[model samples]
Target: MELHIVIEGKKDLGGQLYRQLSDSIRSGRLADGQQLPPSRLLAEQLGLSRKTVSNVYTRLTQERLVLGQVGKGSFVSAPAEAKPRRQLAINLASAAIVAKWDSMHTPLRAPFPEERSRYEFVGGCVTPALFPIDEWRRCMLHGLRQDVKGSGMYRQAEGIAELRAAIAHHAAFARGVVCTANNVVVTNGAQQALDLLGRVLLEPGCVVAVEEPGYPAARMLFASQGARVVGIGIDQEGMLVEQIPQGTRLIYTTPAHQFPLGMQMSVARREALLARALAIGAIIIEDDYDSEFRYDGRPTDSLQSMDRHGVVAFVGSFSKVMLPELRLGYAVLPEAILNAALTVKHLNDWHTATASQHALAKFIADGYLSRHIRRCGATYATRRERLQTLFADVLSPWFELVPASAGFHLAALCKKPLDLDLLLRLARRADVGLHPLSNFYASTPPRAGLFLGYGGIETLDIEIALLRVRDILLQME
Candidate 1:
């Protein structure tokens, strides 16, 4: 690499070279073991004598900042203890808005490297063993070919035409969502869809209602946008529509299957939520995440399907069914919010990745998505059954399983008060990962319960993991 050195009126050329080289070395700009430009070449570039450059190298060598080799050029020496680079001092006055962001909590996060257990019952995670790798690889190849022949311009913010159409058709067929390509907006993930909707619909201090003991990420997201987020308590039906504040501009619900506590919202409550939204002129953001893996009962209509007055913005994600790393999801927006949402999406990230969109479009178009879902569903169903049996037979004394028709996870409310923290610790010690229901609640006092997700853990491993949990509870008793 060419070295940069300045000479002022040809005065103290060696000293100038030494200072700059020393600073670069000390600051880690010239990384350890990196070869410096030869003295002759550097002297020619800087319009200085080779003797001056060599003297500077010699000085650096004496300081132990440079290593001289017999045949090769000088290189930076590795220090025994690498010095940390100096950081700029923060001197500006703190902003109130930034302080608010700092105070916000992130409830849903991946465990650290050390925190990972052998049998993880973590929610929102999928089994890697069940993914259709061969089928997906073929689809990805098709996406690559399409990308190669593309216009090389930024695609539409609403999404590639094929994906939007595919999503519309899939949503209609599977979840009973009524929409066309024009209504769909493909996003990075369901999270981005929520963010775009929040940007379009929510103003600072606007009232937004989410379910108590609900998806914490959604609650924190709306709060980050300066919206006044309120937690409406949930029962067997879902979010209590009667308790929704009068001034609420937005109401977010996972009606297909409630988050953390898995329960499909009843038809009566769905109609009531729609009526409430219509009466208050509030928009409902129905997050239909992980609804494709329903194991029992007849399929129910989504909130978008039940919507009459264009009040629901139906959001869905492929993360639960497919790989979460895909970061692919879509929102079927009502006509009122569609254009504004598209515009916001354009401003957000230009658009979701085109290659993945093309791959998913092909995945759905060729029926691979449906086939994959069926295959994974069977595995998840078996796991869920194992968990149900364990809870019913071995662990019945400590917990009562919440009846849920869909989704990969189950919620078990405690029979009586117990040390949840201690149970989690003991489970971790036994190489089992356990999650509590307390993390989901916002305003209400959290009930003592556990969320046992069957998606990540193996079918056989679920029994062993729960058995260990039961043993821990026995010890506590």
Candidate 2:
């Protein structure tokens, strides 16, 4: 049966509908799993339109107040009772969220690659399908059962000690970088690590050397911190260390699997970079973003392992290895910088989510993380091979594509300048998510080339996305 409650004016559109439905659920006017009236039916009761009712229901669903099953209907949720006591209804359509919008990577629209659907080539992604969700669920269940005791207390500022130890051990064994728990600081993501390091190290007008066409986030973080981010040109080998600006306090590079371009820095270049950093008294922020997924060659030794004068701060994350949503990353710091970073860490979000850190520790210690990386490297390589084969067999004869040497994507170097506005429009019309190379640069206006990411996509689906991509670009020709 349809539930009825009359709502008065325009003000009644939002909260009043929420109140009525919530009160119905809580007061037992609606029982658990009781299906809601269709939006059309609910609108008739309130003398309003369906959208207004749908909006309220949408907000309710977002708040965990009600659950919706598309083919069936919305149901009064038992969990809905938690939010009325825990969170307030917020109208975000009107309020501007004050995130210092980190223009660090490609300007990605929120909800970019919508919820693991087919035909989206969303870049810089890891598959949740491959995640240890069952293990995570078990850990959370166990945490709540025994360790949810600290209900209101803030988690440790240094992160979970066990997790920090696990991370330190993993680094020592996997990457050959030596670090103790004090040297490892868990962050929201690798971006947060960048932000935290930027905040502590960069001063107004300070110079930080960065690679041209580098990871956009590294460039953006240094720039946003009021640092003079000098873009040093890179070659097939790596960043030109000799070109590093004088008096620069830091140099940021993705030496292993350099973003978009996918070339690893050579040992000679690494030595020269370290030499230049030592000469200039500069620190190197090594963004080893996709170092784990090397398809072609041996993984380069990390700069941190080689630092004797403490010139490199290695920043890496499980977000790429795991899924991006987990918000797990770490920065290994030199002793001098460690205390300063910890202070900033305490001032910032205080700590990583305790349960996530704990869960990750358990995952790592039990060998799930390492196990996944091996599988991921093999899996992503297969998808990459298929995409590359499609490009080679089908598209590359006509289009100039840089065979993705490593990482999640392959880049198509356009013969002429691309009108990004029109390209994005075509991609949208075709329902594909790809990145533009220009979005990751320091200054020049956005230009040509598209990044075709294959991580979330299957090897089988690459042919279609590539075909559609070829069709879109061919229109310009």
Candidate 3:
């Protein structure tokens, strides 16, 4: 008959109260149809104002998480499933828990509240101000009309015919990838595309190579599949290909613009990587995630374009160029593995949303996609330049900026030893959304640094954000 709760004065008391109560109900600690203490009485028990307690109840009622009776107390609603029984003792041999699942470690992404910061520089995001909402809506409507007129059936596993063709054309012209509609497989997003490829390619105890200070999700995906993932180091040119350990079955690289570090793979390295893959009979995943917004010199030829031995499986996503929420991306496959990949794709998701694919096809074919890219490219270029200038003038003392040719983000290696954990704490206290470079590494000792993405942060606010960062760096000194 004892209730337990802690009131932390430093945090949002009301929100904490709401979340705790809701969790108690959902977890079955608060029984279904059980009456809660009166608002006045409970407020006194919790050392909160009566109004605060009442507001929590009102909000819960609006969410339909609880029900109130007239002249009675608030009660917990019945859950869709039976409530879990409280555990009495640990069962070491319990069959329910998978040992592998327990061993895996994945960090939750930190949420950045715009209201908390004068300027927030979170990465892997696009500027919302440039999204062509009106045009997108029109294209969406056209897709809807076309779908209604056609037979509604489960679509082919590869993708809708129109979309595949459009993607192939875009890849050939824009990325210099020699592919046809038959080689393309549409996916929910680049993440799902990676998943599908992993499913088809990786096996238990298989060896997979990924860049250290690389994309975590891809590494986790391979690890989850029971593949022994090796973290290969990266330099100014990109991942060290010769360093790939022998017997590696699959290689995943973000060559166009390496994730987190934001450096492009050099031409010689690309050629070397492709040749090595061929020599070892290993398949490579080339994720060209965000090369559509090049602000520098001539664009480097894609690894896929140089691929002759069918060693490269090229992945591209609309998340960067168009919008992340669109959940659209495609993979250009090698002929040998295309059928197997298609089967896995079918099993994984059946197919991506059909209407959206059709609409995106029309958008690309009608030249809207290209035009939007040109418009946004100009905006992103300005943001990139501003960030570069700030680092050169102010942040150069503590940080040596990475020379990135393309993508939404730029990273800097620390010139001096920095306490990254402490820096994160100080940055958070100052309302800045700064991330540590070490977070991207798995096995290798991570280099101390920061990745400042100018994508979501507006051009006007870039200077303000950098000044705050500079102030924080000064405090460390």
Candidate 4:
């Protein structure tokens, strides 16, 4: 066999070797029938110690992965030709319970990028550089230092009292939302918040009004509950409220800047939606997901703030303000539905993690959160401007740049019919990431658009990326 590979020893020696060998197997670089070189000779050739090679081979062989013969040399074992060749698959047939629905098992959790970058413009992530990491870390350490003996104990079902109060105060002040700590419930993230809300609000066969192209997590939750999810079209002004059904339990919306198709709901449409919801006794989920990054002169007051009747559940998150991994988001419920939701929250994970909640509360209360957002918002503003400048110069005249009055991402409407998945693959080969517009839809996919998040990309790099995208689009056209 022939080999062509280079290994870098940056951090951990064992981990580097493990990753290199793991990748070789996964990518089929070392084929099923391939043979490894003798440990001493291979170690000499690769500038590695013979002990290291012997250890690697011994560990792999002890696991029954490779075959070793006394007279004959060791050889790579061929993986069984089954759908999934892992040990679990071999024992699955002998298991106690019947797994009738086995075809759709997902092998992993949420999709993660194959590579890491300081400038990942992921669909929904903030650049860590913008987060007050030092300040937040110090607060976390301090909180732990000052923590009581019961700090590791289960928290109150209502959530960490300080966090709820801080979230309530910040929401009322910044998003024009009105709620008290009693009305607020901390969640793992906006995703879990949606799932919990769906459990409380939706019946198995209930009718729900969802935006045609909306948040994927919400859509999945609604569908999983067997709710009839109806798609409402969006224009420049946001979700057209006219298509909604009367007496519906929920009307999900990202009012500030709609996801994928970034456009704020017009004042008229906002009024119309609230009036309709009030008339039908339906509650509106006012998803103000990314209102903090409003690029326009003045941010509009939220729909929940304007609710005279209790029709809006305002959801806010620190995920946008901080990091995605820190699952901190809150739902400001009206008193009418507060007790019901809290009861469900109490049962569902008992309560949020106390330490994280305490640390986050201090992060916000100490004014670090606001400062980080202000600094990052300005940085994103420059990046957005650079993207706009590049698009104007190179993108086809027919391509439309939809109004993204607020948020890190905006939609780029394509004039031609193109496969978003195929285009995304091509862009990845060019060392770029894209958020396809189709992935947002429940049904009735949009013709073509790209959800370009200008999250943490350096302004200089964005210009070059946009140029590459422009060139790619032109060739595709």
Candidate 5:
């Protein structure tokens, strides 16, 4: 690799090179046993004499920072004590804003590979084994080939024409979402869709109602934009529409399946929410993140499909169903805010990646997306069933499973008062990762429970993991 060393005015090239090389070696930026660039090549690149570069290398060898071989080039030596460079503290002009950001909570963080347990029950993650890697690779190659014919200019802010149409058709067929190609705006993910909607629809101090014990990312996102985010409580139906303030400008709901606590919003509640949003002149963001994996009950119409007055903005993501790293999602916007949303999308990041859009468009058009969903859905269903059985038969003493008809995860409320934090700590010690229901709540008093996600872990693993959890509970008693 070429070394990045700057020589100023040719006054002290040796000193500059020596200091940078030593710092890099000590800091471990240059890993131990990594080959250094040829002295002649580095000298040419740095506009320095070969002799000067050799002298610097000789000095580095003397200091034992690099090892010089006769025929081979010098290599970085393992430092005695590799120390990370200390970060300099600087006062910022936007210190208050930075502090506010620091105070916000991030709830959607996934564990690193090293941090993953043998039985991880983390939500919003899909099993990689279920994805059709070969098919997806073909689509990606096709996308790359298609891009070779492009004009090499920035594409439309609304996204590529093919993807917009594909998403519109897919949403219509699968979820009964009412939309055309013109109504769609491809986004980086559902989070970006929410961010764009917040930018277009929200103002400082405006009231934004979100489901309490909700997706924290959405709540915090609206709050970050200076909106007064109010957490409306959820019951068996959904968010309490009656509790939403009259002056609310936006309402975020996961109607298909409530986040953390799994329950579909009843038709009565859905109608009430629509009426309330219409009356208050507010927009409703229906985040249908993972409703495709329905295990039971008939298919329900999306809130967007039921919308008559263009007050609902339907948001959906491929992250939950396919892979989160894809970062592909789209919004079926109302005519009122469609242009504004497109403008915001353009200003945000121009558009979602063209290659990804192309790949997903082909994935949908060629019927691979639906096939993949069905295949994964079956796997998830088996896992969900095993979890339900374990919760009902083996783990019923301390927990009661929430009645949920869809989604890959289920929430179970504690049957009796117990130290949930202690339970979680013990579970972690037993190599069973779990999520607390309390972490999802913002304003209202949180319920003591756990979210058991079946998407990442296998069906057999679910039985073993929860049995471990049962043992932990019994030991605690």
Candidate 6:
């Protein structure tokens, strides 16, 4: 292959080539045993004399960056250790930042397996083909026109007024959340809403209760703020409210659909959860993430709707319903928490992008958002049914399907314990993606199961992916 090296305006052509080639080898851009271009060919390409190129090759050979054979051309040698650019005044080994960070350790988590896997069952992702590209483009153009004509002023830190009004309207009609535009605070995503809550509500050593086998991102967000996050176990009804410890400062729950394990929080349990938060004076964060798409049963009201006292802050996202890249979600706060959360949000990022906010506002007002959800929901329902049927028919011997009525994924509890390590290895061999249910737990022991997400996976490809999964299961047994 021809190496692209420039020898421009340099008096010492041989020295320049030698330095560049040496840097390439030391950086491992040129792998060991990889053949280099012939000296004459490289000389012509770089507009340098052949003799100059030969001298550079000789210099590289002396530095052990390349090997020369009599008949064969030069080849790259093992990478040499790079020299330090400058002398260090302070050693990292003795720095205070290093010692402080050494005491703090964060768990390593993988990105969505779908990024690399062909037949991905990864959760929390939407199919790009389903996005309303043309409509969104028009809305974006409208936003650009508005920006051009409007006065150049810093917009509201809470959010642009139009987008907040649209979100408030959507929440009131769609999810049974009782709120007005004044009560909403726009955030980058639901994750940022959690961070804002943690900032305003949680102090060091504060106790935070969350559903066990819950959204790991929320748990980590709270933990990063130095709050002691205690995991509360859940039954079919939802989080065991009676078991919640007293003196808790904040509580986080996915009431609409308990994440990973999909089940709605029963009405009685919802009332009990509200009562518990009221009694302890703890703030509640209701993540109504995927509540927009329900397939079965009558819809349940949000915990925020039942609060007579200002105890619940409702957070919703367009990541699951619309597109993850939108980076838009809003929190409907009780009168008491709204101002504090807004301040923290301003401190966080000085509000989310205004242009997307304008675009989304138009999308919602023109009813495009509603239409998109309806279209995507119908497609997702069929995929969900196909997966459930596959689990019931072929995989029933080793798995028990969890009752999931909404959202893009399902969980299957193991019938009998199987070596998860061996099963994962077999799955890798079969080229199927699988995530264990155990990874979601923070305190309680994890149950053996799999979380199969269909958002990114195609409807036609579902059967074929499961067939491979079934084969792997049988081979593991």
**How would you encode candidate 2's per-residue C-alpha lDDT over 1-477 as one tens digit per residue?**
556776776775767888887776666667778788888887887688889889989977887768999798898786534323345777666344234453234454346335433577767776778777787787667555535766668877778788899999988876778789888899998999999889888899999888887776678668778899888887878999888888999889988777766677888899889999999988899887777777776666888887889888999888789888887899999887888898899999888888777778888888888888888889898888787677676676444676445677767666665676786677767876666777666654433777777778876777787788778877877
Tell me the number of clashing residue pairs for each predicted model.
Answer: 0, 2, 0, 0, 0, 0
- How well does model 6 score by local distance difference test? 0.86
CA error at residue 323 for candidate 2, angstroms: 1.4
Better of 1 and 2 by lDDT: 1
Q: Evaluate all candidate structures by whole-model CA lDDT and list the values in order.
A: 0.90, 0.78, 0.86, 0.76, 0.91, 0.86
Give one digit per residue, the lDDT tens place, for model 5 in 1-477: 556777788688889888988988999888999899998999999999999999999999998999988898799996879887889999989999889888877866766888778899988889998899998999998888878888889999999999999999989988999889999999999999999999999999999999998999999999989999999999999899999998999999999999979899989999999999999999999999999989888877899999999999999999988999999998999999999998899888998888888899999999999999999989888888888899899899999999888889999999999899999889988999988888898887889999888888987888888999999999999
TM-score of 2: 0.75
lDDT of 5 at 285: 98
Better of 4 and 5 by lDDT: 5
Give the alpha carbon lDDT tens digit for every residue of 120-226 in model 1: 98898998888988989999999989999999999999999999999999999999999999999999989999999899999999999998989999999998898
Give the Å shift of residue 205 in candidate 5: 0.6
My TM-score estimates for the predictions, one after another, are 0.90, 0.75, 0.80, 0.77, 0.96, 0.81
Instruction: Tell me which of candidates 1 and 4 scores higher on lDDT.
Output: 1
The segments of candidate 2 whose C-alpha lies over 4 angstroms from its true place after superposition are 1-106, 112-118, 149-155, 403-405, 415-424, 444-447, 473-476
RMSD of each: 3.1, 9.5, 10.5, 10.9, 1.7, 7.3
lDDT of 4: 0.76
| Pairs of residues at least 3 apart in sequence or in different chains that clash in candidate 1 | none
Q: What's the best-to-worst order under TM-score?
A: 5, 1, 6, 3, 4, 2
Return the candidate ranking by lDDT, descending.
Answer: 5, 1, 3, 6, 2, 4
- Name the candidate, 2 or 6, with the larger TM-score value: 6
Give the alpha carbon lDDT tens digit for every residue of 347-429 in model 3: 88788888898899999999999999999889988998998898888988888888888887899888988887888778778
Reference-based TM-score, model 3? 0.80
TM-score, model 4 to reference: 0.77
- Please tell me which predicted candidate would have the highest TM-score against the true structure: 5
Lowest summed lDDT over 10 consecutive residues: which window, candidate 4? 100-109
